[model samples]
Target: MHILLVEDDHKAARLLARGLEEEGFAVTVAHTAAEASSHAHAMWRFDMAILDWMLPAKDGVALCAEWRQAQHQLPVLMLTARDAVADRIVGLNTGADDYLTKPFAFDELLARIRALLRRAVRAQHGILQVADLTLDPATRAVNRAGERLDLTPKEYAILELLMRHTGAVVTRQQLAEHVWHADLIAIDNLMDVHLKNLRRKVDPAGLPTLITTVRGRGFLLAQPEGGDA
Candidate 1:
């Protein structure tokens, strides 16, 4: 998964990046709020964001608010030195999915990241579909136009997010949020490559496209009536 880290501590940022990389996650580091803002705006889609409370210009809470204002639904985990109940409440209220205080065990941080991903992956509402595409959360099966579609973990997650929303628009940021677990790898054209691969696997020629781009908006997968083209 791709991650965007908004921490100013150089040593800590590099250290965390190394460890997370070992865990098979792609991570990107942002030292300040301005960097994070610019990075995210540049279509460097992140699955998750790790934000530090203290930054040069704006605090993590303010940056979190800014991301939300931009409709970035990616789960953000706030890492801060403050360890007060009120501070934790404020962090959560500010759109942080979880909080990790300084001097934290990296293991706990990793566990929290996994927990957040588990929450995102589940289908409390069960099956989701769009047109000929169908995803059975219980079976982990996907099918389209009477033909089954094979997907990797990341592809399945992407498709699941789209099917869950069906005809509703899902932006790249939203997709990143729903699919990204912990680390976001910078310098990788991961999302672009994956989307292209998914399209190829799911749609061959002459098939009324199931996954269609909404231009500047995002993407939508509409459920066709009775699987009709």
Candidate 2:
């Protein structure tokens, strides 16, 4: 998922952005509200926004209100040092879906973000199952035939995307754009290498290959019969 992170403190923003990226989110960092507004104006597709209440020009509350006024439905999580009930209420009134105070634990922030994403994805966030393979997006868990699978962040992202579009061919461009940000160009065979590694981990010994390559087109996730996938 792509995230818009608005934080004014350089140190704090750097730490938080690194943490989010390590957790498998594509994050765009903006140190000021104007930068955040520019990103929004560019029509960047973001799954969620993490905004700091304190800013140079426009505060997070105002930015969130502006987003609401602009009919942007992206979930917003407000971060502030103000932990008072009234302050939180004001933040919520400004259209923030969740709140996290300063000095908060990274784990808690991760949980809140995941919760908001799940809420936004209503039907899309649940446990996805296909041919004895199961994936729980909420917990980032994947299991096949009751056996747990340990997958890297990139592998997990690719698997989840394919699972989301079961039986459909997911183009290389699509995968590249989502997995690696638009600014980063996907090198030749990068996708193939990751998919190959994912296939090896997901389809164990004596199991049918679940990922099907369509030569020059893309990949499809389906149970193939009596043939190599």
lDDT accuracy of residue 142 in candidate 1: 86
Ten consecutive residues with minimal summed lDDT in candidate 2?
179-188
**Candidate 1 local Cα displacement, residue 29, angstroms:** 1.1
The digit string of per-residue lDDT tens for model 2 on 1-229 reads: 8999999999999998999989988888999988998876543357889999999988999989999999888899999999999999999998999999988999999999998988877745578888879899777889987889999998998898899888899888778766766632544478778888899988878887788888888889976575433
Q: Would you list the C-alpha lDDT of every candidate in the order shown? A: 0.80, 0.86
Q: Pick the candidate with the highest lDDT.
A: 2
lDDT tens digits, residue span 76-152, model 1: 89999999999999999988999999989999989998777666546246666566667887678988778888899
Candidate 1 regions exceeding 4 Å error are: 42-44, 123-128, 136-140, 145-148, 153-229
Clashing pairs in 2: none
| Residues forming the 10-long window of minimal summed lDDT in candidate 1 | 180-189
Clashing pairs in 1: 2-183, 2-184, 3-183, 3-184, 26-184, 26-185, 27-184, 27-185, 131-223, 131-224
